[model samples]
Target: MAVKLNTPIKLVLFDVDGVMTDGTIYMAESGEFCKAFNVKDGLAIELLRAHEIKSGVISGKASPALTNRCQKLGFDIIETGCKHKLPKLEQICTNFNVTADAIAFCGDDVLDLPIMERCGLSVAPADAHQLVLEQADWVSAYKGGSGMVRDFVDTLLLSQSNIGLKEIYQPLLRKIALDDLTGVEQ
Candidate 1:
């Protein structure tokens, strides 16, 4: 049997360390925290926004760098240092007034299981742990922080032909009627 994303997701949730940052942490001599992020994933977030999909970041550990990155990305929800994610998931659901079935979550480890189990669509990176890969409804071909989110975003957007992504672009195109088109051609 094959598993697929049956319903279109309105919200996208991601884990920070593995899904967005390649699961690596670098501590400088001065104790500054840093993580490497893939540019492709950042573009994926832009694509999601183009299609009017809400997005957020949920991480077990907190980092100022991660917070700034998410803010710059325009993610709607930012939950950091959350060891217990289920409650946070509930809070998101409530805030968005969206059902669990309209959410997609991509995770790479054990801590992500509970919410993944409850979400309508669950994804894991190719390099995720054995247990997480086994439980995932969809395992991405790309590894974490290496275009995994891009792969998922592409798949999700491709699956929505009827929704017409062109329509999403039209509004911005109109604004560019020789005016607010500062970044329209992009």
Candidate 2:
């Protein structure tokens, strides 16, 4: 179901593990951690930025992979190693000068409940925990790490009478020739 926000969305927050990486953690023999990220999700963050809507992460766990990905995505706010999300969310609201009613938060587990309750919009992935799904104002058809973020962004923008992926991304193809295409360096 589509959720029309009472306030315009100024900021969008996401929980990292389940919401961003399908709740998977890969640990190397040397004790390093690796997490896979969807490029489409990165593009979704960019889409929010293009529309002057800030995006951020508030996650309990910390890892180098998550750090690098958030940087590459150019997130407006990044709060990792955060055990209690509600307080951090409050601080983020204060720091960003945005009220809770103007925020949209996507989460996938129980830890996300408090913040979800406070934000103007609460979104969850299709495969999210039942509790989270119940709390969500809107749910994506895609599961976490599988274009869930993209679906959320698409719906949010569309609800605002704003442009979607084709309008924002299709022009890039015209700007760069296929012959010049190369894999992303990062």
Candidate 3:
């Protein structure tokens, strides 16, 4: 079944390292960095795109690996090297005209709290920092880089049940057309 959000969960932002990857920074002899991401998490993001909910990535660090992943996942917005995520997230909300309360952010560290507090739904992985887990509205059953994102997305999809009857599935192009009706310029 597909999940459709009228407004409550219009956008979902994710933290790259701890939330998507295992939070390991592998530095090779040539100063190359490598990060391993869960395939299930990638599929979850793509599923959201199919369901009319846009997804974004706001990470505190930058890496070619992260960029490649975002591109492959068809992320609606991607911002890296942002230690302070709230500010960048605010800009994204403004551009898309997404209300603060309609955004859901998933993170796994203390640095993610600022934005987490502002968003309507705050999600944390089971292995998230103590403070982060404390602040989250929902904590995943799975650990980061281990299908945790899939777990979060599943719960979000399930929550749409009480949101009223609507379409169960929306094709990508139709979803994009509906999104334009909102103040989401592009």
Candidate 4:
């Protein structure tokens, strides 16, 4: 069954490696690490914040970069180094004063299954593992860290007819070429 995006969504939870960084862990020669994040996804998160939707990140790995990124994104909850995610999910729900029916959880790996099953809506990236894709209520056409989160944000905002987003994006839409407007290159 398709999860409806028109409803008021209270919380949005994301998985770090795959959903935020294309699932790659890059280590430099000097042991400094880095991960690529999509600018569009960053902007989408900001939009979600503007609409008063609470956002968070839950990652199995603990990295300084991830922490820094989460801080920069203004995420309300950051759960890192969590191998088992169910407890973290429960804690976040309690902390937010929301139920499973009001939250959306996006994940891309088997480790994210338990929470995904419990969320109101479950999302997966296009390149997510088979199990995760199967469990997701929606699988984004765009891959993680490559505009998948942006796609999800757009879907939610458009489906809800969010006035703020409409006011911002509608003007830009009019300026784009028709092919670009449809996101299809001719």
lDDT of 2 by residue, 82-145 (tens): 9889999889989989999999999999989999999999999999999999999999999999
Clashes of 4: 0
Q: Write the per-residue lDDT of candidate 3 for residues 2-119, one digit (tens) a residue.
A: 4334457989999988889889989889887789999988878866877778999999999888888888888999999999999998899899998978999999999999999998
Model 1 Cα lDDT, one tens digit per residue, 1-186: 133666879999999888987899999998888988998898788778867899998899898888888988879899999988999999999999998889999999999999999999888999998888988988888889999998888777767655555664454455546454465443
Over all chains combined, what TM-score does candidate 1 have?
0.87
Sorted by TM-score (best first), the order is: 2, 1, 4, 3
Candidate 4 regions off by >4 Å? 1-7, 162-165, 168-186
Candidate 3 lDDT trough over 10 residues, lowest sum: 163-172
- Candidate 1: residue pairs that collide: none
Per-model TM-score versus the true fold: 0.87, 0.89, 0.83, 0.84
How many residue pairs clash per model? 0, 0, 0, 0
CA RMSD, predictions in order: 3.3, 3.3, 6.4, 7.1
On residues 1-186, what C-alpha lDDT tens digit does candidate 4 reach at each position?
A: 234853478899999888977888899898877888888898778778766788999889888888989898889999999999999888887877898878889999999999999988899999999999999989999898889898888777666664665675654454345648679532
Q: On a 0 to 100 scale, what is the lDDT of residue 69 in model 1?
A: 89
Query: Whose lDDT is greatest here?
Result: 2
Please identify which of the two predictions, 2 or 3, would achieve the higher lDDT against the true structure.
2
lDDT of 3 at 54: 93
- The segments of candidate 2 whose C-alpha lies over 4 angstroms from its true place after superposition are 162-165, 168-186
lDDT over C-alpha atoms for residue 146 of model 4? 87
For model 2, what is the alpha-carbon lDDT of residue 48? 83
Superposition TM-score, candidate 3 onto the true structure: 0.83
Clash pairs for candidate 4: none
